[model samples]
Structure formats: C-alpha cells, structure tokens
Target: MRRLASGPDILLLAAVWIVDVAVFSTLLNRSDSPSGLLRAPVVVGYAAVGAAALLLRRSHPVWVFAAVWLHSCAANLLPLGVHPTAGVLVALYTVTASRGEAVGALAMVAGFVPLGLTVAAEVRAAAADERITILTANAIFFTVVGLLVWGLGRWVRANREHARELERRRLAEADAAVAVERRRIARELHDIVAHAVTVMVLQAGGAQQILGTDAARALRTLRQIEDLGREAMGELRRLLLVLRPSAGDEAQQPVDGHQPGLDDVDRLVGTFREASLPVRLGVCGAARRMDRSTDLTAYRVVQEALTNVMKHAGPGTRTRVELNWADALSIRVTDDGGSPPRRASAPSAGHGLLGLQERVDVVGGTLTAGPTRDGGFEVNAALPVPTTEPDRARSGG
Candidate 1:
C-alpha cells in the first residue's frame, strides 16, 4: 500500500506540535491569574487534537485546514495569553501546495475571518483603549506571518510544476528523435536490399542464358553474383550491429570499418556493369574528398538511380553516370530508355526517392529526379563542399 504521508511530513508535524505546545505552556506558566490554571488542561487538549488533525493534512488539506483554523480561533478566545495558530499555518501551507494558488488565497482569507472576529470581540471587551491597540498589533503580526507561509507554498508549487513540464518536453523530444532514426534505418535497408536483389536476379538470368553457349562468361557472371551477395550480407550485418550491439562491440567500429562513399562509387559502377547494364562513368572537374555524410549521400544517389534503371527499364539500357567536382559536387545519372521495354511490377511506395530527397535536404543539398525530354529518366543532385582552411584563408585574402 502507498503511504499517504512521507517521512518529512511526519517530521514537520512533530516540529510544529512541539513548538505549539511549548509556546502555549510557557505563556500559561507566565500568567499568575487563576483563569490560566483553570484553562491550562483545555489548552493542552486543544493542541493535541489540532496535531492529530494535522497528520492528515497532505491527504485532506482543505478539511484539515478548516479544523485547525477553527480550533485555533476557539483556543485564542481563552486566556491562554497567545494565539495557538501553529497548526493553522502548517495546514494553510499544505492547502496551498496541494490545491494551488487560487484555493490557497481563498483558504487564507477564510482563516482570517474567525481570527478577525475573535480579535474584534477581545477589542470590545477591553477595559482600556491601549489594550485594543495591543490586540490589533497581534492581529497584524499573525496576518503577515500567514501571508509569508502561503507565499512560500506558492513558490514551491510553481517550481514543482515547472520541473514537470520540462520532463514532459524532454520525453517528447526523445520519442521524435527515435522515430526519425527508425525512418533513417529503414531507408538504408531499402537501398541495400533493392539494389542487391535487382542485380543478383539479372545476373542469374544472364548466366542461365549463356551457360551452354559461353561457359567462361557464364562462370564470370556467377562469380560476380556471389560477390554482390556477400557484399550485401556484410552491409546488412553492419546495420544489425548498429541496431543491437553487444557490450564488447559497443566500442568497436562497424563490421567493415568503412561505409560506402564517393570513393566506392567506381566499385559500385563496376557491379552494375557486370550485371549487364551499359553504364558510362564521367568526371568533369578536379576530384576532391568530401565529408562522410555528403560522400555517402552521393554514393546512394548514384546507386538508387542505377537500381531503378535496371528494375524499371530492364537490362541492355545505356546509362550515363557523371560527377562534376567544382564549387560543389554535381551528380547526374541519365538512362536512355531501351530494350525489353519496361517490366510491369507492383506499384511502388517510392520510399527510395523520398528517402533520397530527405537525405539531400539534411546535407544542405538539392536533388531532382524526373523523365527527360527524350524517352529516359534522369536524377541530378548538387552536394555542397566544405571549404578547407587553405581555401578559407585564400578567400579571406
């Protein structure tokens, strides 16, 4: 079962109870009047009851405040020489902290009512005018003290609410980041699987067609297929390591320690050529290295474009892959639509194109893909190049 009151609550109750009893008892002893002796036991009993009610303040703040406030007012009417308002103040703090500012203000005002009435009665019964001044002074004192306690409670409540809002926002951001990462992983897997399967299927068909007529060529095609399959498996394993790494693997690099980037574009083109796609590679400017992300994006752009060519346009299509390295890297892959017409596959969700667009946007680059004026498809991407320190200095000069 959950505990209603915590350790700190019990400690606070004990502290308040002790102070109230001690103050009430000391005031009673200082009084030489017979009325103080006669009402001493009653005062002690009242303090005990107020303390008991305070134990439930956290669970039932409003009711406890009412009980303690009324008890304090009644006890003040006696000749105990002091207002036994310790419990009432404690209850008021609890009410404000739990119920909120508006309710706390109302409770504070409600508490002052009976208190004001008691003070007014005492003022009227005073024999001298100066005695009325003392009563008013005491009333003002207690009122100021109550406001301070209530304000403290309001401050505490404000801080608590602020902390809760911060935690909620943090959790929301974490969930959004996780969703973005999942989409990113999905895109990577799609590029790998789609490109690999397309090449392998085409190679298998070509090998079968040439097996009896050209055994040597067929053997080469079969070997290329085996190599592509292994590369695809390796990339898949790298992704798995990223998704679920063991304790020992956490600090280690990816399975191959190298991700496919611009440097691997040559090898990429070779794979498609072996699969029987007539692809031409061209570079128009001085080649330079790029940041890893931009490099990977460039490679994927070329890869997905070629994969789509083979999948939609079938083999024997003449494809051109060009790279222009100037102020920025420009990649263009265009296919002149050719033989076997186009295969009628199931409708595509277009995840490849969409994922490529998102990736280009992340790298502060632009990408466009559509059919050309001729009966062919084209994909163009411009990736920004980061300026080296020497270039920056030269430009500054």
Candidate 2:
C-alpha cells in the first residue's frame, strides 16, 4: 500500500494542482483553435495526474519522474496549449537530488527533448513574421531553466554527502582517542597494583622469618605492609575518581588528597629499606620543580624499577636510584645483583618495562633497560623538563 503523504506533501500537491489548473484554464480559454478547445479536458486530466505524482516524488523519485515524463510527452504530442508543468520540474529536481549526476544527466535529456519538440511545433505553426526571434528566445529560456534546476539538485546531494563524510571522520577520531586513554589508565593501574603487591609480599616474608626471634622488628614489618596496602588502595581510588565526569567543586581535589611527586621518592625508598632492600637515592646537580605529568612519570619509573629489583633480584640486593637535573631530568635505577629466579606465576618480565617505555614516550622522553656491564641490570630514562617564558623571566637567566 502507498504510505499517506505528510501535511507538507499534501500542501505541496494542492499548490501544484492549483497552479496547473489556473495556467491551463487561462491558456485554453484564450486560444481560437477548435482542436485546442476540444483537447482541453484531456489536457486538464493529464495535468491533474502529473500534479498528483508530486506527492511521492521524494520517496519514489524515479517512479515520479517516469510518470511526469510520460505525461509531459503525451501533453506535447497531443499539441495541448500548455508549457512544462510544475510537477515535471519538481520530479526532475527530486531525481537529480536522489540519484547522482549520471542518472540526473539522463533525466535532464529525456525531460528537455519533449519540451524542445513542443516549442519547435509551436514555432512552425506561428505566423512567419516573428518565427526566428520567438524560436531563439524560447529555446534559450527553457534550456537555461532546465539546467539550473538540475544543477541545483546535484549541489544539494553533494553537500549532504560531504556532511555525512565529516560526521563519520569525527566519530572515528573520538573512538581512537578513547582507546588511547583506556590504554594509559590500564598501564597506571598495572604499575600501581604490581609494585605495591611485590613490596607487601617481601615484607610479609620478612615478618614470617623473624616473627619469633625479634617480635618488635617483625611487628614493624607487618605495620609497613599495612601501610603499603592502604597507600595502594588510596592511589587506586584516586585513579578511578579521575576517570569519572567531574561535577562542580568535587573534581578539583584528588580523591585520596595526595598527589605523588619527586618529593615522595624518600618515603618510597624507606619502604624498600624496611623490606631489607637497600635503596640508595643519589641526586646530582640542583633540584627544581617539574610539571605534574613529568613528575609523576619520574616517580613511576623509579617505583617500577625498584619493584623489579625486589621481584627478580630478591632480598639483600643493593639498588641505586640516581636523579640528574639538567636541561632534562634523568633517572637511573641499577642493581648490582644478577637476575635471580622469578616465580612461575610472576608477570612477564617485559610487561612492566614495556609499560614504562610507553609512559616515557607519552611524555616525549626516551627509556633504555638492559643488563649492565657489571653483571647487573639497569633501567634508565631521560624526561625533558618543560620551561615556559614565565620561568625564564622569573629565573632572569
């Protein structure tokens, strides 16, 4: 069944039919030819059928075009005293807009042929006094009008396709950004949990061994384990809170009310000290403040390096963390002990290192990790310290 026309479609159909009736009535009434007067009803009926086809032009453009084209040819062949109807023009525009240039070009040719033929017939029947002038003017007028309608329809189709292409590209870019952010969050979560758990395990092992011989020291180790667990939980909460959409004032403060930075290195080293891993922190050149991202990257690099030392190098390993502040901030974590046996269930050796490399790359830095010449392992990174014009002015250098 044909779907019902909308209010706008109905209005359009009524308007086109009214215009066709008015134009045909005026033309037929003014004509002196008996044959034209006799064909008046036939012309009106064909015009009405063509006007009704306009209702479905947008939904079924090709069918509407076919119907209107046939009507136009019939009206022309009958030699009715009428011009190209409004319905024919509407159908031509719909076809070009819906079907592209190739089909549009064909419709234009098919539509204009009958119009040209009717004009030629009219020109031949006219008195010889003004035949050439009338033929030239009418031919120019009709051709220009037809081309304009067809061009306008093609332009609308091109614009619509351009807009759709832009929308598709925008959606693709948004999806890519989301995937990158998720990967970053995953790296952070892995680093936080893995490092904290490694420390807790070492502390727990120490506490178990010395529980009877030195109850106080073992108790201290147990307390350190508890602290590490709390810290990890706080960091995880903060990270998760950062993922949520912020509302007003709640988003400004860190969820755990702490932002880890280079200053936290001493406290971080203290935990490993308690676990009996001697971590010596060495600072070279003057220390200066860094932006939060670079600062966090620096801290995470050390944290992951030390965690690896604890996991692979085992206890009693002498680890060194050196920070060199210059045009760039350099971090070096080294352990003198060679690689020890890692547990079968431990994470792959490359996972943590790969995560660290990604973090460094994000901050436009470089990282290198391998066995050192002294039969040990080392992880080193150089992170650039961003300096703005304000800093240069403040320092007066």
Candidate 3:
C-alpha cells in the first residue's frame, strides 16, 4: 500500500514543530533562570506540558493550540512570556495549510485573537518608562513571525497545486496510452480472426461438396481446417489476454504482429480508395526515416486525420494527403468533399482530435485542427523525424 502521508511534506511540518519547541524551551529556561521552575514541581510540570504540546502541535493542532492559549493566560504557572506563545503560531500554520481556505482562515483568526489579547495585557502590566519599548518590541515580533508563517503558507500552497497539476497530467497520459493500446488490439483481432474465418469457411464449403466421392481429398481438407481452427484458437487466446490478461499471464504473452507505421501510408490510402474515397498520398522533402514511436505517431496522425475527414467532410470532396519527410514530419490531410453520397456521425461522437493531440504531444509534436478558408476541415501535425533511417522506411515490406 502507498504510504499515507508523503515523508518530505511531513518532515517540513516536523521542522516547524522543532523550531517552535526550541524557541519556547529557551524562553522558559531563561525566564525561570533566577527563580527557576526547577525550584517548584508544579511550575516545572506546566512548563513541560507547554513544551511537549509544541511538538504535537501539528499532529493534534486544536488541542495543542487550546492548551497553549490557556497556559498563556495562567500566569507564572505557565512557561514564559511571548516566546512560549510561538507554538500557537506553528499550530496555526499547520492548520491553515492542511485545511482548506475556510478552515485555515478561521483557525488563523482563532490563534490571532488570543495572541492580540495576551500582548495587550502585557503592555498594560509594563512600567511607564518601558511601556512604549515593550509594546514596540511585541509589535515587531508579531510582524516578523506573522510574515514568516504567511510566506511559508504561500510556498506550501504553490507546491501543493503544482504537485496536483503534475499528477493530473500523468494520469491523463496513462489513460490515453491505455486507450491507444486497446484500439490497436481491437483492430488486430478484427484483421487476424476475419482472415482466418474466411479461409475456414471456404475450406468447409469445398470439403462438403465432394465428401463421399472424394473421401481422401475431403480428409485432407478437414486436416487443413483443423490446423486453421487451432491457429484461430491461439490467436483468440492471445487477443483475450491482451484485452484482459491475468497478471502472470500478461508477463509471458507474445506481442501482436502489427507494425502499422508511416511507411504503410500508400496501402492505407488504397483502403480509402476501396471504400471509394477520392484520397491522394503525397511525399515531399528528402527521403528520411524514424523510430517505431515517431513512425507510429506519424501514422496515427494520418489515420485520425483521415478518419476525421470521412466523418466530417463531404463524400465527393477530393482529399489531399501530404507527408513531408524533413526536420519535422508534417502531415496535412484535407478534403474537397467526395462524390456519390455524404453522411457522418456527430462531431462529439469522435474522440479522434483528443487522441491525436495526445499522440503528437507525447512525441514533442504540435497539432492544429480547424476549418480552412475554403470551408474544409484541415489537420496539420508537425512531428519530429530522424535523418539516419531512410533505409528502413524505404525497405518497408
């Protein structure tokens, strides 16, 4: 299980506790130096309670603050003067920071009100010559301590918000990665099983046609059918594990035999032609190549861009596909609306834009999607392309 509280954050709070304890202990010791609490067990006990309360201030803020406040008004039965009172400020700091704005402000006010009253009482008890001096000193102390705690509060708040934003971005990336993997697995299952089933059906039909007259041939066809069936079962088992494998099974499963990437753009365009979309594939700049991540990112950008076009643009529109092989892999898929018929799902029904944005961003790429001046929805993504692997992309088989 994850640790309940983060160690570093707690340690910072612990530092506040130690400083508070030290400040009070020093003041109490000095205040009782001549007429020591060591001379009286009762005063010594009260002082011990006050100091320990400082250490536990963050852990038990309310109780510790209240105990300190009561002791502040309880005469020499308490520790010392204003120095011992710094513990309440530490509690206020913890309370304000850990709780929300409402509770934090309320807790701060609770601490401040008592502190103000006690300081005012000390001012009243001072001799006339030292009255202004004592009041001024107390005012400065409050100012310094209050500002210090306020600065600490701001730092704590800023760090907390930054940490939250980092966590949110991480979680979003993980979700998108999982989604991409799931969709790829689905496409593989569609391709693999569909082809296997088609072959199995044809073999079964042929075997049925001459079962009695061509018994030997029929047996051969049946054996072939059994082979295909076992292959289908193995593929199905692997796909199921990919979709939702038990933990140990997940570790040993073979990866899918799919390397869909940028080099396959021509074949991808051929499919749109099979579906009767007037799509064109164009390549510019010197021939270059990319790693699997870059290639896959480039391909997915095109795939999503085309998918968007099919769903958003006119069917009769002439689509232009441009893949610039340069410092950046520039993808521009725009359409002039195809012929015959046009139909599409709602814009929000597709998460292609969100998915594409995530893909490009991961590879330090940029994507811009909107309608062009010609009333055509256009997508432009500039992805990082490497220079050294032209051979691999050219030899794509």
Best by lDDT: 2
lDDT of each: 0.72, 0.73, 0.64
Q: Arrange candidates, best lDDT first.
A: 2, 1, 3
Question: What's the TM for model 3?
Answer: 0.52
Compared with the true structure, the alpha-carbon lDDT of candidate 3 equals 0.64
Candidate 2 segments whose C-alpha is farther than 4 A from its true place: 1-5, 24-41, 79-84, 213-397
Model 2: which residue pairs collide? none
Q: lDDT at 377 for candidate 1?
A: 79
Model 3 segments more than 4 A misplaced: 1-44, 54-59, 73-83, 121-126, 241-397
| Backbone clashes, each candidate | 0, 0, 8
- TM-score for candidate 1, please give it: 0.52
What lDDT score goes with residue 33 in model 3? 69
Q: Write the per-residue lDDT of candidate 2 for residues 312-371, one digit (tens) a residue.
A: 777888889998877888999988863453333333445567656755765578999877
lDDT of 3 by residue, 1-397 (tens): 6443466645644554455444433344445565543434444444456555665555666676678767655632333433345556766676666666776667666666656655665577679898899788977777677657755765687789889999898766556555665455444554666677899999999999989899999999999899778767755764564464222111111267565787678888778777667888887766575544556678788877777777766354678888777777788988654443233222332455765675566556899877654556678999876556565433211
- Report the candidate with higher lDDT, 1 versus 2: 2
